[model samples]
Target chain A: MAEVNRQILLVSRPQGAASTDNFKLVETPLAPLADGEVRVRNHYLSLDPYMRGRMNDTKSYAAPQPLNEVMIGGTAGEVVESKNAAFKAGDKVVGMFGWQEFGTSDGKGLQKVDDTHVPLSAYLGPVGMPGATGWYGLNRIIAPKAGETVVVSAASGAVGSVVGQLAKLAGARAVGIAGGAEKCRYVVETLGFDACVDYKAGNLYQDLKAATPTGVDGCFENVGGDGLDATLARMNAFGRIAVCGYIAGYDGVPVPLKHPSLILTQRLLVQGFIITEHLDVWPVALKELGTLVAQKKLHYRESIAHGLENAPEAFLGMLKGRNFGKQLVKLI
Target chain B: MAEVNRQILLVSRPQGAASTDNFKLVETPLAPLADGEVRVRNHYLSLDPYMRGRMNDTKSYAAPQPLNEVMIGGTAGEVVESKNAAFKAGDKVVGMFGWQEFGTSDGKGLQKVDDTHVPLSAYLGPVGMPGATGWYGLNRIIAPKAGETVVVSAASGAVGSVVGQLAKLAGARAVGIAGGAEKCRYVVETLGFDACVDYKAGNLYQDLKAATPTGVDGCFENVGGDGLDATLARMNAFGRIAVCGYIAGYDGVPVPLKHPSLILTQRLLVQGFIITEHLDVWPVALKELGTLVAQKKLHYRESIAHGLENAPEAFLGMLKGRNFGKQLVKLI
Candidate 1:
């Protein structure tokens, strides 16, 4: 293991859209861990929508990543050294290891990974934070019943792909919203959604109306904009909206809600939830999502960018909807 | 008693904002009630923001008022004559009596009222549907804890006024947003809110910041527009917003929400609820709210318009922010 580690830090806050200039690659010497501490060499770093919020220093449910600090992110890695009894050297693990090659932890939140059964990269994609987030939120918040229509945005992404499959697993008719025809096909054909609406299609309203003829009973919202308003217009009475993410407005440009009246008229329940808020459900969520993936009941795709050097470029591409699915950085 | 009854009906569905032409006042002969039916002489008719949704033909939780049909509304009145076992002559009652001087009911939802203690007008204001809506939503949905700051829009109106008071009763500092200084003062001093910001004061952002230094933890939203957007900006992490109404956007004219980005970043919970959805809690809610009003713990104001002919003017005035409090029409 190297004594010096490279990490990605925030160079500056983005005004409208995040760019490569917003990040800086820095090198620092690794320090020995104290009691109950473990050091892990990150193999796979997860890039997600929530990371965009941490880029800003404003107050949020989770503390914002401070300027010049290693940008906080999720990582799957193997323990290189340990002072904690719970973890051993060479054991695969998953934790908030930030955007770094090596991370030191006090073993407070590290979870052991079973790499023998699944690849280590799965921890950053299908069976990790993103997967469990979709599981817990869809199961608990929207709680789609049989015969109900479950609409999900970003349907081919890490979180939303799982949400579509989970809704189908629970016997609900899953309808997905994606940007391109290819992504829409993947969501409908591979993930087995009942229908897929291409939001990039200029006729979003017509597409949504045709897709959800019976109206949406549950909506897992990842993208919010004119599409959000359109979906809201087609929602059934007493519909539940799990506000998991707002990738549509991540551009920092204000998108006016075209149909603010839908909230009241439909008696919609729209709630913004962070998966970390329900950490207690992680064990069960991980086990279930893992089982589904292993059994081939769920399928996922990832756009892997090799090396830490391409992390910023990959992240920028992901934000621009250029990536096909879960965007990940591979560091070996 | 006159054999014929005069009534207001929906002439046409509003494409956007409702106009006086949308409502038609017509006289029709009264039909005698059956053995189970009771005749109610309207005393005070309630005009509320929810009525705006009813004017639209779109599918909503509450069915839209059909064109050429009597306009739906809530009313407090006297049971002038009754053939039902649940009601008697001269008993004051509250019900869905529509926009008319008199109506017949079968006592399915009729609640007999004794106005010997609180005035008859209180039934249409603080101790009635508006009061119950505010109290139930604030306590159950928003659930502001002690020391949390709760902000309410349309704070001098029926529902917002009660919401502010309920928040204050729960030991939270309540701030109100209203149209003018008079309403603001009434919300703060009369309703016991900590402070009230006048949106018409031309410094809404500055006033809101000064009023809620610690930030808004809960918001009882009765108005949706720029006010809702402003409140969204001031919301603290995990703030719960109970969407009681959208008075600001009811007029088919859209006040675009310029900042929906805050919904995701702040982890705000925005739930649009109807009090009637949970009618089982009404008895409990009324009992509690009654105690508050009787003990001088809650205060309410009424803007009563005399005669059923003036109901249209009263409703229009309320829509224009001219009504002082709960706008009501006195039939007798």
Candidate 2:
């Protein structure tokens, strides 16, 4: 058994953009588990854009991540040791284990997950928080009807990929906006989106217009820069926009929407939502998401960075649109 | 009846700010009414800010006011001669007679009303489209619960006055944003809004923040610029914003929403609506509004100019915040 545990701690808050200097890697002896506590060997650490928001002490739906604490994150792993009757050795679990090699929990938020059909890493992507985030935003907010056109920004990322697929499952026309040609191709070919716009191709407005010949009816907005501005311009009358993430504005400045007058002219409905605030939906969401994964119908890709020490780089890369899919770090 | 019918026509579209040069006052020979037509000598003309958007040849929910034609406007008058059996000669009626001294209608869209209790011009302001505008946005979109704070921009104007009054009736704390001290006073003292922030005071953000101690739960946005930007900063979680009008962006430019990231952090629902698009609700909305006005429960004010030739000036002044309430022109 591993006698020592390694963890990444946020040493300081970010001034503008976060860097590895803001975090410190530390080694600590694994404390003996208290009564009714279970120890987990975290296999994969989920690196998401939301973590960048947590790095700053700004007003947000979720509380700010404190300094000198293990960086907040989602993890999927196997139970290595247990002092609780509910958990046993080798049982797969999904929990907020954060950026660490091991976690000790009283089994409060820990959920026992099965990996008989779906892979263990997938619990961190599909059938997990990201999957549920996509489901709630698409289903509850956007509510795309059959034959309507739905556009998703950051289409290659964890949440957006699921949104496009589910939008397709709802029989709506799914379109995607990604940063590159390769990711855009993958989005259309593999995810079965009707069209994909490469935003980095230098003509986002024209490309998106060309891609969505019919104006966008529903939009899952993950990137909020020129992509959102262009989407606002092309939206049909009475369109719906689900504001999920704004990776472009996560640093010190809040990105301004360039054309807000479209909200009046087009009569659009723009709603912002936080997935964590809606905990009541998880049972139904996870049931559907978990079933799709078990049946091998849900398609997903991963960009895995080996070693816990490389998590910061992978997360920072995902913010820059460098990672192709779900960004994660493999600890084992 | 007058042999010559004088009318104001939109001769040319505005380049930037509209002026008297954009309209041409001409006297035309009154056309003879057809068998099914009714001729009405208009007494009042409603000059609204929406005319500015139509003058600029810009994108909007309504089509641009056509050039070289009688300018579009709502009017109230008594039917002077009736060829249609449904109308009598002295019956008071309301119709879109534009900026003209006389109108001939087939009675398709004309509505006869009883003015024994409510004034004739009240149909153009409170018991008319403007009143219904306030009703739909406040009731359907904002839907504020008791004790929730609702802020309305341009609170002294035609639509805004009604919005604040309706919100107060719904048991929400109504805060208004008006242009000057006098309008702010009227918004609070007469319209019964809980508070009014004078935007010309140069301390909008601070004053609004002080006024809404519990934060704003709903916003009825009429003028979109710094006022809207400030309101966005103060919105609470799950706030609802009904985007009714952006009078600030009416001429050749669209206003951008600064700090749009607040939409995500606050989890707001921002929807834009055109009152003209909602014809079905007018029946019920006007009934409630008319009863309130007739019973003197709803107070209203107006800025009236006395000639059709002066409508261009009145409209421009209303757009500049010179008018205190519903801007109108008395044709008689």
Candidate 3:
């Protein structure tokens, strides 16, 4: 068994943009597991935009991460030691294990994972929470018909990538909006989206308009700001917008929507949701995502950092769109 | 039958605000009715805010009013001459007969109205399009539960008056926002809304907050502007907003919504609709509205102009919130 456990703690809250200075890495001695407890050596720690909100002191869908505590996050790792009958040693599992090199649980919230057909790290990304978020927003909220145009922001990220691909599978035209040329290219060529608009191209409105000639019928918005404004301007009458995540405003001031009266004139429907509030759809979403990933029908990429101490930098980088696809820290 | 017919034509589209100068009144000779045609003497011409959008050359939910043609409007009148089997002289009917003292139709679009229990003018306001608009928005879009607070804008106007009353009937708390203290008093005292906030009182946000001690759970918006912004700020988590009309921005620049990211944090569902698109619900809505009005449970007020020549002035006044309740031109 490992004698030392390393963990990252949220020592301070961010006033505006989050910085690594708010976090502190600590080395602590691992104690013997109590009865029915299982100890896991985390292999991958997920770094997502939602973690930024958890760092704030304000109220949100979930409670704020307490000061001087292990930062909350999702993790996929192997069970090094188990006193619980439900989980055996050498078994792969996933749970909210925080930013740590090791985790001890009573086997309540943890779920066993299969790593034969898919890698264990994938349990933290696609075929997991992010994948299910895209599924819920696209199928339940947007529900675009065949031949309709669906626009997705953050098109190369974990959730947005899955959204575009799923929209294409539904026989809808998928148009992506990404930060740069390379990400946009990956969204179109690698992900098989119909078209991609480079939001950094300075002509966001014109570029988005040019891409969606038939006008956007549905939008899965992950990054809100000028991108959302541009998309709003191009929506067709009766368009649906699923507000999944507003990563653009997570760290700074929020971007206001201009011409909100367009919502009245165009008769649009805009809905916002948090996936955690809906646990009932997990079985269905997970089964389909697993089958797609195993069949090679769904593709994904990951930006991984080595060691637990670097998780804060990786998380900050993701907020700036510096990381590609799903951001994770390989703690093993 | 009258030898001369008085008609109003759309002379020009307004650049910003609509005015009487944009309309021209003329006297024309009434042509003899052809076979299957009916000549009707108009009793009331409905002056609604939607006419402002129709006057613009831009595309909207409905087609724009043709230049130099008779201005389009809904009218309730009695048939003076009929060569068609579907109607006879002295039968009261309602149809889109434009802004004219007299109209001749093939009796195809006309619906005979029975004014024995209800007034003929009620067909153009409470028991007609405006009433149905409120019903669809409240029942279908907002869908507030009993004890939930529902906020409505344009509280004393045609559509909003019905929305608050229906919400109260559904056992929900109805709060209204109107332009003046008189309208607010009418909404609370006469319409039986739980409370009404006067938007012109300079403390819109604070007043709205005080009126709704419990956060607003649903909103039926007709006049969008500062009123809508105030409502948005006070919405509860998972709140629903049904966008029916934006009379505030009909003739000028639209008001933008600030802190749109609140939609994400609150997980709100905002939907806009044109009532005409949902014709399948008309029978259900009309039956309920007619029953309520006949039972005296649905109370309404009208501001009537005495002549057809003053129709343009009435419509322009309605656009500026000058006329109270439902604005109409009564041509005897």
Which has the greatest lDDT?
A: 2
Backbone N/Cα/C clashes per model: 3, 0, 0
Q: List the residue pairs that clash in candidate 1.
A: B16-B252, B17-B251, B17-B252
> What is every candidate's alpha-carbon RMSD to the true fold?
2.2, 1.4, 1.4
lDDT of 2 at B185: 95
Over B193-246, each residue of candidate 2 has an lDDT whose tens digit, in order, gives: 999999999999999999999999999999999999999999999999999988
- Ranking according to lDDT, highest score first: 2, 3, 1
C-alpha displacement of B80 in model 3, angstroms? 1.0
Query: In model 1 chain A, where is the ten-residue run with the lowest total lDDT?
Result: A53-62
lDDT, candidate 3, A46-141, per-residue tens: 998888988888756678899999999999999999999999999999999999999999998999999999889878788899999999999999
- Model 2, TM vs. native: 0.98
The 0-to-1 C-alpha lDDT of every candidate, in the order given, reads 0.86, 0.92, 0.91
Which window of 10 residues has the lowest lDDT sum in candidate 2 chain A?
Answer: A252-261
lDDT at residue B77 of model 2 (Cα atoms)? 96
Compared with the true structure, model 3 gives a TM-score of 0.98
Report how closely model 3 matches the true complex, as a DockQ value: 0.75
